[model samples]
Target: MTVALWCILIAFLLPYLCTYVAKISGGFRLKDNHDPRDFLDSLNGLGRRAYAAQLNGFEVTPAFAAAVIVAHLAGNAELVTIDVMAVLFITSRLLYIICYLVDWAILRSLVWLVGMGLIVGLFVVSA
Candidate 1:
């Protein structure tokens, strides 16, 4: 797959990592509830932060995927542009996760902005 497509794949998995952390850290039991949201409400501290990150990860997916698809369809995106921006987005997201887990709100926000910018950059390149 292209690097951009690989980025999409990685993006798809990002939320799951947070979910895994939340589940393991929070020690959520499968029988606790049938509803996922209800189960998620039990998270606290780092687990809660992870849940927030996971939510952000899911929230960002549609826009990121659309940007990538649009860029690919526009036929304006260079491989380097797609690859570099994808890497930047992924790196920023990874850092965001770490910052969130550590309770570094300011840094996490900045990192989130960087990732957003990279997402926009992907759209720009495709345009």
Candidate 2:
């Protein structure tokens, strides 16, 4: 598969990584599994931020995946261009999670914008 396609897989999995962080930091246990959302909602500080990031990750992943697929299917942009943007989007998401955990709101928003721009750029390049 293409690197961009691989990135779609990474994007899909990123939220799970954030979920893991939230769980580990929030002291999740087997009992919490019965009501995981409630357990996640009770988290504070880093755990809460991680959970929020996880939700955001899930929100944006589909768009990123779609952008990559559309770019590939359109077959207008260079494969390298699409791949690089995909990688950059993933990098921005990682930074966004770190920013959220560290309470860097402004930086996190900027990183989020960058990710969004990368997604748009994928479509634009395909044109």
Candidate 3:
């Protein structure tokens, strides 16, 4: 429960951090009312990718939490491994977003592999 809660918090915060980074790099005044389309475009696709990554995190966390809870309810305390997995997923997501923003191709792909591994690992170990 604590792990899921922290994951939810990080999931929410990542997008906000991405948005702020976009604003700073795009030279948009953090206060003025301006079109997001233009500002985001100026960030060169990283802003969009960051937003997508955040969405992905939000979508995945709930199912992961549910599975962990189910495992716990079934008397499998090892479900805590799922909690650790969720953390790894979040970390990889952050790395993926950062790598994409910086155009680090090989490293970005590796980060993506880490995220996928976490998801698969959760199911495999839980079973």
Candidate 4:
């Protein structure tokens, strides 16, 4: 599998990390009947961000994975193009999580844009 595929695997698990963080935060009880939205409110600091990041991670995963798979199989782009975009996408995602946890709003948005661009680049350069 390509590094991009490996990154997709890693991305698959990123949300669980955020969930673990949410549990460690004030919203530790996974069994509660509370709405998921309220769980975020219960968290005061990094915890809230963790929950938000988890949701965001989920939001991005499908598109990323689809793009990676389709691009890998159908893309006529140079291997270097594929590889570079893949690595950068992963790097941006990891950085995005950190930026979320640290509450770096502007930076996180920029990083997200970078990630999104990489995804689009992957698709565009693919056949």
Q: What lDDT does each candidate get?
A: 0.87, 0.92, 0.66, 0.85
How well is each residue in 14-110 modelled by candidate 3, as lDDT tens digits? 7677666666656677465656556654555655565555555566656555654554455544646767777887888788778867778799889
For model 4, the stretches where C-alpha displacement exceeds 4 angstroms are 27-41
- Model 2, range 1-127, lDDT digits (tens) per residue? 9998999999999999988989999999877677777776578999999999999999999999999999999999999999999999999999999999999999999999999999999999988
For model 2, where is the 10-residue window of minimal lDDT? 32-41
Query: Which residue runs of candidate 3 sit more than 4 Å off their true CA positions?
Result: 30-34, 45-77
Q: Choose 1 or 3, whichever is better by TM-score.
A: 1
Give each model's clash number: 0, 0, 0, 0
For model 1, name the residue pairs that clash. none
Root-mean-square deviation per candidate: 1.5, 0.9, 3.4, 2.5
The 10 consecutive residues of candidate 1 with the worst lDDT sum are: 32-41
Writing each residue's lDDT as its tens digit, candidate 1 over 8-109 gives 899999999999898888887778557656666777898999999999999998888888878778888687788778878888989999999999999999
Give the true-structure RMSD of model 1: 1.5
Residues 69-119 of candidate 4: C-alpha lDDT, one tens digit per residue: 878888688767787788888889889999999999999999999999988
> Looking at candidate 4, what is the lDDT of residue 98?
93
lDDT of 4 at 14: 90
Per-prediction TM-score: 0.91, 0.96, 0.67, 0.86
